[model samples]
Target: MNKKVLLVPLAAMTLSLVGCGEPDVDYTDNTRLTMRVHVDEGSEEGNGYKEIITAFNRENNGKIRVDLEFVARSGGIYETQLDNDKRKNTLPDLFTFDAPKCAYYAKNGYLYDLSSSFSTTEQDNFVALNRYQSKLFGIPIQESSAGFYYNKDMFNRAGIDVSGITVDNPWTFSQFKEACAKLKALPGLKGAVDMRLDATADETATYLLYPFIYSCGGSFVDSTGLHALNYFNSANSKKGFQFLKDLLDNGYTGTNYGAQDFFTHQVGMYLSSGWTIPELDNHVKWGQYFPDRNSWGLLPYPKADDGTAVSCNGSWSYAIGNNPRTDKSNVVTLLKYITNAKSSKVITQHTGMIPANKEAQVGYANPGSAEDVLLQQLNKTSVQRPETVGYAQFSSAFGRAIKYLKDYGVDKSVDDAAQYLEKELSRLK
Candidate 1:
């Protein structure tokens, strides 16, 4: 467990900004530190990052200028792309990535260890998923909550009242399934769909499915040991997998689970993230594409087999990439600006994501509103993905397992899939 050393003279010295309230050092040098920021440029989130950078540069007045390096997501993929760039000594000065990646990146020296970045008091103010062990790498810039979104018009027409389904009296998985059946029986109504918009993407499938498994009393990783083999195929996990298979086998979901179809009354319950709140709030329409628009209903994910309600709480995070050529001070300053409460509020507002700042959330989340529910789950019952260094591999493997179950209902092939995942993760040890 030896740490991989990057050997940059001043790279490890991050500016401690807690109560210092300033960027630690003023630039009489004002050398116009031109840092390269790598981002998934073709994406909406990437565009949001671009907007933040433009604003930051304007505010700083040429002290720091960022050249957005539009990295295509095709080459080698997450962490692999960064790893490849690192091997060539061409890594960008900064990159935005998933929060779960800090474990892998920090352990192997792909990131600067940020132990000095936040004071103990500031650490307390941070959301739960941002801190990892003793060395923090990724700062959770934006977070999200996944839940069941039902069409209120459909529910009322079906003579079903979902008005009382509060955080305290949420639906159990079985109860939710039964309700979906009743809703499905209504003329022209289809059953619920998985929250993940894309059925084939590995990351979304596994991310959306974990809450069900955790609610059923199974975990994908034993955090104490950071291992997957012994836990992923447990009995409760099988029960959870069976539930997913049932969703597919009974013809409950497919393409129409999307926003447009749900808005048009083609679907009953739409399971997805809190990002839908704004659309519902504004009564969004697709240029006469859909005939009906009902106010959407939000509820926490259905209760598990054991009645333990759970929510997936994680976000896209930013990391200081290893770059010997860039000014370490400037890079850290940008990181501070990107994650501080003010910058975080701007990013969340521009990107339509939930803020990681505790105080900032209170300003946006009205009492008992959809935003309020999302904040409550993120703070209370959220289960973050395991912080193992093998997370990228684990997510891909688990995603494949889900696809296997979808392609061919939970059969003997699933046992083989579990074995493959276990073997893949064991190599990391």
Candidate 2:
């Protein structure tokens, strides 16, 4: 039997060199690497990642071994844990993080450069959005987008036509507001849920909610990336904020999310990724709305006043940690295997997320499905989260400011919130 191994959390290089050419034990294992993965347990992506790890280990047996650490998808707590790990230098050899955090982590000197190692043409095979300021700090394993999941039963009962809420013909801000108003009129139904307002939705405001601003022809930050004062507090931005305020202030959206949420028809709409979809195999047997599959649908983000389509895009990707001890060759090997066309196909099949590799994108499973709709939205209307060093602080402050509005009411104007956000940003700068 192989000798017992003591896993060093993130030290791939140091641990790999323990013996003359292998571990001191008779095991003769050449390389051992630790990996940390963050995706909800039982989630499609989580299951896909686990499968990938298993196959990788089986193939690399006796050559390289991996110590896998799985973490849940709680944005607030998970990021905090990662930060603590970084400070204590106890992070795994590599870990998964949302691509939006690329700038923040890279700027703070906490990642390996993957872009520089790839050939120009080879780089073309991967998703174009992984680079952070020209340097590839991470590789996107999958992709998701901003969209709406509405209750068809609620629509039918409210006598609202759900046709307009499609990718080709998205809901306008006014129409969306009107629909929410109608949804509230239904008996025993609460309203909608703009999940970004959830307290634990730390990075969500930056991803899910920003589309509201973008969909309204409003700018959140200037080209200089140093200001949100005029951009966020401006007249155009107010139009979006006011629309959101109306959703809550007028009782078109519920404050809390529960089991009785969207699926139960308690809330008419849920704004999130396709990952929220349940197993379609059971759809025919039972469900409130979308029982026929064609009954329910996904829609693009509401268009801006000028009819400009917009959406939020990105997902958890793999990045090498900045710890001093790293097995560069082994790490690169693992990354390449996981990101290539073959692996991408395998992963997308399990995660049901869009593929990050260009070739695999074409082969992504379940075309013309809810997940496909999300992929299409990403292609048509999506925008990447800002690759700025201040993104973390920016998201935090913005989330709090929006939560204040969501918690209070319309009285908490976007103008005041913008001012408060500007002040918070200055401290971070």
Candidate 3:
């Protein structure tokens, strides 16, 4: 439970920002700080954070203590709580936030400038850190990569072989459709794939599905992170979205599938991230279905027509609040403890996410393991979503556009979802 030696170098750093005005909290007290995280108190992810905090407290003993707050993510409750806190000026000394929100939070002054907490060399150690306006704001808790999960049994029944498919050598868009076709023809299957369209209400749509756009060399925003015109509505971007539309049009996937359809054996393939592995394991342990460890396999995202294999990356990260009066040294001490290589491994162990710290990734995955495959994607093909102050708007808008495609297919004149996406992003400025 002891922290790694990584904290020694970072602990000496100080917050460079001056207080905005009169401090809300007692600047004299730096020992007792509060931190909020988005997870149910009893969930695995929540327990992981608790374990880290407990160890941190035990190590610090009486010198420093962290009061933990659990803000459940269900129904956008976590984000809503943070919004309420921001309005009330009661934000915690430290908090965990989604990576995509880094821009919006930094732009709105919700996070502290963490450039000092992590040195350039240290920052380079994490797979992805949240930065805005050329300043570091948040440290990634873990790196993320998404892939297709195919039922091994179903694949075998369809006489299909996926042993050659890998993160570097993935199926082409057409090959993916062909595989779905083969799977659909099999008897007693709900559908060929579960695209997770049911999860469109929140960030999942944008986080998980954006690869479809990027694989075809599309982008949600330009390099400046301030525009989403031709970048989002280009012919290449349209081709990416068109692939999704074709899935629905061809009856390869549909809107009616439940989120757990894959686990329940209702689908041949499910598009998801590393977290799905734990879900499948839990379901098997609970006797929900009798599938052994080899019953399913992970796949890299399909390649675009241009032979590009792009996958999603980025996850929740720890960020100090904007309160300049708080004891930055104490808060950052805990932040380094929570995000250090050892902490990264512990958290990823429970959550099934890849460790963000490069050191943690070392010896973490076995050769040819599922985690290895995901690690390869994160290292080689994964891309973070567009960093923009308008990301929240873009996430919601993109999710809605995908839903629009689901609600109204190509035949209904909704095939131009990219155009709709472009139009929505156009209003961001």
Per-residue error at 215 for model 2, in Å? 2.0
Candidate 1 residue-wise lDDT, 1-429, digit = tens: 334464342344433334435223222333344333335676766676777778888888856776666665565465576777677655566776667777777777777666676667766666664445656777777888877777766777777777677666677777777777677778876555544524546577667777887788876766632566657777777777777777777777653356466656677776667766666555345324223334666778777757488788887777776655444777778877877788778778877888887766767777777777777877777888766777877777667767677666554435656677677767877
Off by over 4 Å in 3: 1-24, 74-77, 88-90, 283-290, 406-429
Model 2: lowest-lDDT 10 consecutive positions: 21-30
TM-scores for candidates 1 onward, in order? 0.79, 0.77, 0.85
Stretches off by above 4 angstroms in model 2 are 1-32, 39-47, 57-67, 71-92, 126-128, 184-188, 192-201, 204-206, 222-226, 256-259, 279-290, 325-329, 363-368, 406-412
lDDT of 3 by residue, 1-429 (tens): 447566654554433233334346554588888899999899999999999999999999999988899988888888887887787677788999989889989988899999987778888888778889889999999888878888888899998888888887888998999999999999888889999776777777778888988888877777666666666666677677789988988889988898778877888998888877777777445244535667778888888868489888998999998764555888888888898899999998888789999999999888787778899889888888888887866777677667877566522322344455456556665
Q: Tens digit of lDDT per residue, candidate 2, span 152-245? A: 6677888888664666667787787787878778888766554546643556556777777766667766654557788776777767666777
The TM-score ranking, best first, is 3, 1, 2
User: What lDDT, from 0 to 1, does candidate 2 have?
Assistant: 0.70
**lDDT of candidate 3?**
0.81
> What TM-score does structure 1 among the candidates reach?
0.79
Point to the candidate with the largest lDDT: 3
